[model samples]
Target: MSKEILTTKDLHLYYGDKEALKGINLNFDAKGITALIGPSGCGKSTYLRTLNRMNDLIPNVTITGTIKFKGQDLYAPSADTVQIRKEIGMVFQQPNPFPFSIYDNVIYGLRIAGEKDKEKLDAVVEKSLRQAAVWDEVKDHLHESALALSGGQQQRVCIARVLAVSPEIILLDEPTSALDPVSSSQIETTLLNLRHDYTIITVTHNLQQASRIADRTAFFMNGELVEVDQTKNIFMNPAEKQTEDYISGRFG
Candidate 1:
């Protein structure tokens, strides 16, 4: 693998002539947390989505420059979108579980990827659930409706769903924004464990959450990537004053 697991060079994104991300250059090391923090509409989520080509699903969205994973351009015409997405899974702000049982929810990704063997699916479900740290709570109730799960459990279920596909990088867009304090802590602990195996890139409006969980941090303002460095440096003594201002709650 390359020294940089993921890289974006001069990336510019436009949603029908409205520039959402300015020429942004970024790089991610292997199996570490990189948090994108900014105010609302600063393009934090937009920048995160572009990494895995999630923006491809939208209409009239144009992207420029190169986004590479392991030295291969992600936007090449011959690139496989489905395969790209599978390798770089995403969890959203809201925990949107499918209308199915807990067991089914974890296996949905495998099933869609054409894994039909019952033994393999079961193993994956168990491994992924364990990885997401929700297997024990819902193990006895695997057959119960996913909708019956509480907001936090449902979010972990979503995380398990993403893990089942064996993604190399996980993109989280405010994964804990909808949860309570306890639920937020649960997700944070889970993410810390996940960093051992998966490269995590998260976009969060909460500065404290970034401080707690991120290995490195990037700050964005008005669609421009302002500062990126170690989480401690970015928060404690930011190279840019804007980062200090944001974290200090002087201005968002």
Candidate 2:
């Protein structure tokens, strides 16, 4: 069994007075891909954002629970939200790169963190692009505006930017939902390879994509986690009736 990197203990989230997450307790495996699947508006995205306190950006969004990273409470008063986000990187449903040169886009985070060393920035930019599998393709055009890249390449650049930050975990919220098939496949391959270095938690509505890359699958419904198990078991022999119904095309 792999080590548990992050654990959510009865997580509850609320947007204003409306509850979004209902006491979720789940352990994310270190160096493995855990896919969260469910119908639309099932709180998969909400749960993903809570890992790094992204929900805190919204006013009146209340979170009541302990999220532990390596057994340390992440919601503690002393816990640094910025550092937590750095350690737990996130990719959104849409490819959103900074409107700057490709190189600048990847180095933006470093610049914000007050890194002024040019040589170090250049080296990390090259290395992270390669890690994201787009270095060779974009090396000659690093100065080009990031927005000029194709949607898939832009998404890859976003990945490179996150990789450059050296996060221990990557949280993806339907990352491939906006890409073409080829681009989506490339990102999938990149994600598969990234698992060797970081734990991945993804919320994808695409059942096929979840089946392809997830080592374990979690089913959520109406803000509740219904079932979680290995990919094979979840798809072939789910322990819960709702899981079976969802997987067999009966319902979301």
Worst 10 residues of 1 by lDDT: 1-10
Residues 1-252 of candidate 1 have per-residue lDDT tens digits of: 365899999999999999999999999998989999998999989989998888988999999999998788999999998989999999999999999999999999788778899998889889999999998999999989999999999999999999998999999999999999999999999999999899999998888999999999999999999999999999889998888898898987
| Candidate whose TM-score is highest | 1
The true-structure Cα RMSD of candidate 1 reads 1.1
lDDT of 2 at 180: 96
Question: Which pairs clash inside model 2?
Answer: none
- Candidate 1 residue runs with Cα over 4 Å from true position: none
Instruction: Please give, for residues 1-252, the per-residue lDDT of candidate 2 as tens digits.
Output: 248899998999998888899999999878989999999999999999999889888899999989999887998999999899899999998999999999999998898999999999999999999989899889999999999999999999999999998999999999999999999999998899898899999999889999999999999999999999998899999999999999999986
How does model 2 fare in lDDT? 0.93
TM-score for every candidate vs. truth?
A: 0.97, 0.97
Residue 51, model 2: lDDT of 94
In angstroms, the error of model 2 at 25 is 0.6
RMSD of each: 1.1, 1.3
CA lDDT of each prediction against the hidden true structure: 0.93, 0.93
What are the clashing pairs of model 1? none
Candidate 2 total steric clashes: 0
